[model samples]
Target: MQTDIEVYVLSCPTENIITWLEASFTLVKKSTSGPLCSKLTLLWQGNEVEVTILEQAAGKRFTSIWFDSDKTPWEDDITCAKQVFKALDCEVRCNFQGWEEEGNQDPDLWWRINHHGEGPFIWN
Candidate 1:
């Protein structure tokens, strides 16, 4: 049920990704004032991939981590996800009192980590 890392996705736009892609991006999901977004099917490398913007903590929470990484959207979503989460974390760190591990520093951390749940990059 496993496969290679999904690339060419709408990644969360982590700072690292911003540095990598050298482009600025944003999440187009329900958490914001944008149009309600539904899970969309996209073609990457001629492969069909499933993509969704995961929402957490009720309406106050929102994130589009691009669930599948073995497809095109994976790269775009995760990269963007990383950046968006990082940005969100940077801002909420002071107001939110909790130890949320920022994205890993290792380039292959997401792929190398021993996943206990769903995938290789679940972190814990």
Candidate 2:
């Protein structure tokens, strides 16, 4: 199973993201990495998970949440995306399937969860 998780949310405020992270995980440290990015270090299940929040990642619409560790709780990006959507009550997007270097995959295809529903769609 995949350990790391990366997802994207559309039109979400940075403060809301921090609030959700603080409520869900034990926040260890928070730092402003750049004008449009923030770095967060969190502890989950006794493992350190580094998260990077990047605004305007997709043409000024989507913000990327990158969990840079294999110790994330979820199995994959889609699972993490669902949890994030439920917590933030916003639109979340993730890759349709786990990455496979030698396997055929459509990079534009993504699984999206929003207020309306969840489904697969071409992102770009």
Candidate 3:
């Protein structure tokens, strides 16, 4: 099974997002076959797990993170997800399968999927 998540930014993104991400994790490989993207593997519970900046659009960015439902703690996985939000420093909508819907008080961290024509969504 594959676990995936997405973060969308409505405002223009800056280099700080990438800078912060690189600073937080280890980048193993960059994709040579598709759009400009990278492969990152992070150490969780003493094991290396694969994560990737699977998609990048003008205002929409998607991260592909994998977790074993039987073994990996959701807390650990979500902590990694929070890093993406921290790096962007802007309003972001997070979409990941399996979590119950709960409203947010902060506009900077939205959990629903709503997009305007301000920027590319990376994937169609």
User: Mind sharing the TM-score for model 2?
Assistant: 0.95
lDDT of 1: 0.32
> Candidate 1 — which residues are off by over 4 angstroms?
1-37, 57-59, 73-124
- Candidate 3, position 76, lDDT: 38
Q: Give candidate 3's whole-model lDDT.
A: 0.43
Clashes of each: 25, 0, 0
> TM-scores across all candidates?
0.31, 0.95, 0.44
lDDT of 2 at 119: 97
The lDDT for every candidate, in the order shown, is 0.32, 0.91, 0.43
Candidate 3, residue 100: CA error in Å?
A: 9.4
lDDT of 1 by residue, 32-71 (tens): 2234333444444566655443433113332233435454
- lDDT of model 1 at position 52: 48
